[model samples]
Target: MPRGSALSQSLIDTAHALADAARAETLAHFRNPGLDAANKAAAGFDPVTEGDRAAEAAMRAILAERRPGDGVFGEEYGITRGSSGLTWVLDPIDGTRGFLSGTPTWGVLIAACEGTRPVYGIIDQPFIGERFEGGLGVARYRGPQGEAPLRSRQGVALKDAILFSTFPEIGTAQEAARFREVSARARLTRFGMDCYAYGLLALGHVDLVIEAGLQRYDIAGPIAVIEAAGGIVTDWQGGPADEGGRILAAGSPELHAEALALLSGTAAEGAA
Candidate 1:
């Protein structure tokens, strides 16, 4: 339960291993001419490629062998419940659209949860060799360049912050309006980075990330990474984000409070 305990280290190592195994599987199918991409959404064009299935399957295999009693929840495959309180969450290719479009921003997400709380997480971008890992009291970035400690920016003002969202049309009418409210006040706003945006936030390159219509797998890994890096992550209403719809992450507590006030419409526009 305490930070940096033996159990935490073991879970972190397991997360890295799972991400490594998934990276291999996703790389094989990524951007291949023969890669089969199909729509998984009922009425819209939500894509699922062979890479997604293969990568998740690969990670599931490792979990089955190494943490046999742990539960597994993956995007491609359905849930495999385990008696152990730990549940491994997998999103083989987080930015599937980016991957299909040959963008290197896609990442493999792996997280270990004890009950409803995430204890460890890793965001692995194999193509670029960047791995952002965090849990309990530790967060770090590892890549071909080198490894370094991670910390969020301090004293960031809301009006001067950089913001990101996966897409503008992602959520309902109200959610879109809420996002617009925050984006309008930020110094700059960018779109289409997917989960990669969260990693950038944790690294202090970006200051805020607000998005809606997300599942648990989408934010669990990033939430752990961001929080461990000293950022705040919560639902738009400033509640727990573990269930994942309408989430907000900020580099500092002051910034987070400012964003939440705007998001909740408690602070009028142009209010200091």
Candidate 2:
């Protein structure tokens, strides 16, 4: 918005609009047996339902109408021809497996990026009527209870913290092995959370969020929201987690490094 004015409220509006559109379109497919789920990547592989495709298409359409020049790269649909610096990364449905199973853990993820770096993000859980959005300076939470500022939990060590993730099913072979090492080092691990799992981690209910086989859209929204909420997020290799590799986010820098070392097999029992 306004060419790089990330803090400007106008920028926030676009993010919110896209979030609203994607969330509505995604929920429209819930509980509808008639909806089609097709293999989008490899054969018998990652599924893409009408929900995902329509949600992304809806977001793209809104961008076309409101921010005519902004580029959009989505999970279901490919990139649309538009601007580069002003971009929107979207995961129309994060927990598609859960969605297909009639679970409500799925949600719509969106983030605004400038020059390949995120400036703002919004994760909308339409079924639960909740939204996590923020960027420039700070982040805020709005839900059925109304709006409030959110902060990460303070000063927790790995042994005392709770960890959340997608588990081995969502990871590649190499990533899965690395994840086992990390799990052994964590206090505890829980499975079957998509993007919502990361939101819970950022909100301080959980301490660490480690996910693998994630696409750009999968991590972009969570990265912006969590970082804005004062948590640290990065790739598994201890580098920037801009959809570069896998993702690991922790409540603090200490935990972030410790988790990275555990996954990397270089740590000596929380030595990081």
Candidate 3:
């Protein structure tokens, strides 16, 4: 719905509540020596820790009490259909692997999505005590340095851009080759920041983040936050990215276009 509306405000409030609940639950198991994960993937090591489940359950409990009519699509619990025409997309810990490794980059991602589009979102890092919220006329960061408005960097050329991806060997072989093509021209390319990378992008500390083989919950919160901070987020084909798949987020439209062209293998000669 529209920003500042009663429903909008309520949704924003509920998102924060969810984040708060997740922070408490996730931190309880964050660095515990007994922390163990179950392989969720059939072929590979897709781990899910106790912290992930506990956090999602806590968030779901709050939603059941506050926004009972809203649907939920969570990484741990799957989907819970509701009648409110909205869905709470939750990834209790966006980087379970890193969380298992005791890195502070793991985060709780919560987005109040209307249909497939996120209307408000929060990326909360419990260990760092940092929260980045966007959408619904709110784009700000709260961290040790204090609160600040979030504005993505503008006018950075492709060659000067700082690029980030969660994994160096992104997606399939074709996708990895495409990613390398863009990385070759960027000023710097780093990996494995997870959702924290998106937070940095919205804060204007980073310029671009590209990833593939993502689910809706993986990118929904980041999409709302980054776009609210004057950034552009789309698929490699330049389509709406909230549905996931391949995502390309850049601090500015010009930079996004350059990166998109390269990712799609459509840039003209010398465009990079």
Candidate 4:
């Protein structure tokens, strides 16, 4: 349907319910998170924990019972067969390292992409007690029953900006150098943040999110929420969202292009 006017209300409700359940499960583990992280899939990569596995499993089960025809692509568990028209992308824990580091940037992430294009998105930070969702030209945030409109900060300069970046895990040396060079000139830099920083930006807390290396799961949910809040979400070269090489999220389009001009120069040098 590509997020038409006549979308499924049932699907939206299912997304909310799934997000709520994920929040509950993730919150329980957030308080008493025990470390049993194993490298199951990749070398030096932490596999799914009891919390992640349980949460994803629960979501999978619920979806199976309700929308049994929708396919799923989860970071922890991998792909499933169902909706070719609708795909559910899940990152059981977006910032597991942050989750383990006693930082609050860790959270649960999910998005319903209507055929590789995100139509509905949800970012649930259970520990901090915030939930952000965007779809169908409607983007807003909520804590409980009260929903409020979210607006991005306007008239912000790059040198006077706050950047939320996590480059150490995903970037190569060249990419890291470029990230550092650009971030060093920013007003302040916060690192190792995943979707949480984007959520904050959507809520008008931060200014920019610069990502050089990412998969579809990393910025999938944020793209919709941040844009819904009247911000810019794009690749490093300032293109579409899902192409996935580098990403720059900014509060305004002007700042986005400025920062992108600087970062893209770096990317060009690296290519040279």
Candidate 5:
């Protein structure tokens, strides 16, 4: 089936419910004095906590009951191939660094993909009671203030745009140099927001997010939300971000185009 064809309101509802259940498991470990974290990667800092495993396990159990035929690909536990073409991409705790340090910026990311294309995504920050959902021709935000439609800010210039990256040290030397080229031209640049920055972009608070060294689970949910909110998400070379590496998101197409030029090094520094 094509993207969005297999998706229904029922599936979306189930996605939200999965996030809710995962949130409970994650919260149980969040900030717990006894919570233990270990580095999963040998070279880089890839922290995995008991919370991450427990939360993903919780969601997988729910999926086994709720969507038995659907596949599951998760950050913590890896893939469970299913007969159904639709697959759930999950990151139980997107910002484990923030979660470990007691910051609420970390969120539960859930996305449903038809084959390889994502059709539905939800960024659930349970601690803050905020949920940003997109796909199915509508994007919405829910929080203490209540639910409202989401639309990205339009016609923002690159020089006046707000840029975010999970870290300045992402990717190789060449890639980092390319990122700095764009960051130098932006009006303001902030780092360490992780997936939260993408949610903010969908809400029109942040303008551009450039990051590298990401997995599919990291970008899937954010891409759905940003695109549904009238934004653009693509790789550094202007391609789909489905496989997740060196992704850039802009609140508007114009901003994206301008940034893409710099990221590709096709434009001179400070080019208007």
Candidate 6:
């Protein structure tokens, strides 16, 4: 869609509305002592709480009412096909672990996608009263201090960059080794920020976020936001990361190339 077209505005408005509705549902269960979780994983612990369900349901309700022709794909509910060819991809609470731990790093991810590509997206942290938006000619951050343009830090070298990832283990043992190759060279490396790390990348506070074993919802929103902020997000092979596996996000192409070389074991002696 054209950046400032009527459809673009309408979709943007609906995205904010969906975020608002999700905020209420998620906040209601955020730190509730009575809140409990169910394990979605069989081998280890992958938790899903009422907050995830309720928040997604609330957003779906708004989509069904206002954008009935658009499709919906959410973490909790799977997919609901529509004729418009645009899907609203949602991860009601991107970090269930963080939410369960009562940390503010968990966020609600909302993205309007055309096929596999996100055209507009929002990363919202309800507890922090912050929202990062991008795509459709929009790249902005709105929070307690007020709204501001979102711009990724430019010309950062990998050795001087700060990096983030949700888990120290990353994907598999080999993937973890690849991650360590990059982390070993970074000026600073932090873990466990979930989607909020992407928000920080958009705000230029961080330079890179690498992860693996993600779903479409895990990355679509962040991809839109970070790309809008003039950053780059792709798989380790420098391919599309929208479908979600082994993502490498960097604030600048220089950083991206340097990190990509390390991740892929293709770095020259003095590359980047």
Q: Which ten residues in a row have the lowest lDDT in candidate 3?
A: 1-10
Candidate 3 lDDT? 0.93
Preferred candidate (lDDT higher): 1 or 2? 1
Best candidate (score: lDDT): 6
Q: How many steric overlaps does candidate 6 have?
A: 0
List TM-scores for all candidates, in order.
0.95, 0.91, 0.97, 0.89, 0.96, 0.97
Report how far residue 72 has shifted in candidate 2, in Å. 0.9
Candidate 3 global Cα RMSD: 1.5
lDDT of candidates 1 onward, in order: 0.87, 0.79, 0.93, 0.78, 0.91, 0.95
How do the residues 1-272 of candidate 1 rate in per-residue lDDT, one tens digit apiece? 34457877777777878888888998998778777679998997789998999899889988888889999988889789999788888899999999999899999988888777787788889898899988766799988889988788889898999999999795888778878888889999999999899999988899999998899999889988998899999988899998788899999999999999888777865574
Model 5, 127-245: lDDT tens digits are 88899999987699999999988888898998999999998797999999999989999999999988989999999999999999899999999989998999999999999999899
How displaced is residue 193 in candidate 5, in Å? 0.7
RMSD of each: 1.9, 2.5, 1.5, 2.9, 1.9, 1.7
Q: Of models 3 and 5, which has the larger TM-score?
A: 3
**Model 4 residue 261 distance off true place after TM-score fit, in angstroms:** 0.7
**Lowest summed lDDT window (length 10), candidate 4:** 1-10
lDDT by residue (50-133, candidate 6, tens digit) is 999999999999999999998999999999999888999999999999999999999999999998899999999999999999
Of 1 and 4, the candidate ranking higher by TM-score: 1
- Candidate 2, residue 108: Cα displacement in angstroms equals 0.8
Better of 2 and 4 by lDDT: 2
Clashing residue pairs, backbone N/CA/C < 3 A, model 1: none
Q: How many residue-pair clashes does candidate 4 contain?
A: 3
Off by over 4 Å in 1: 1-4, 269-272
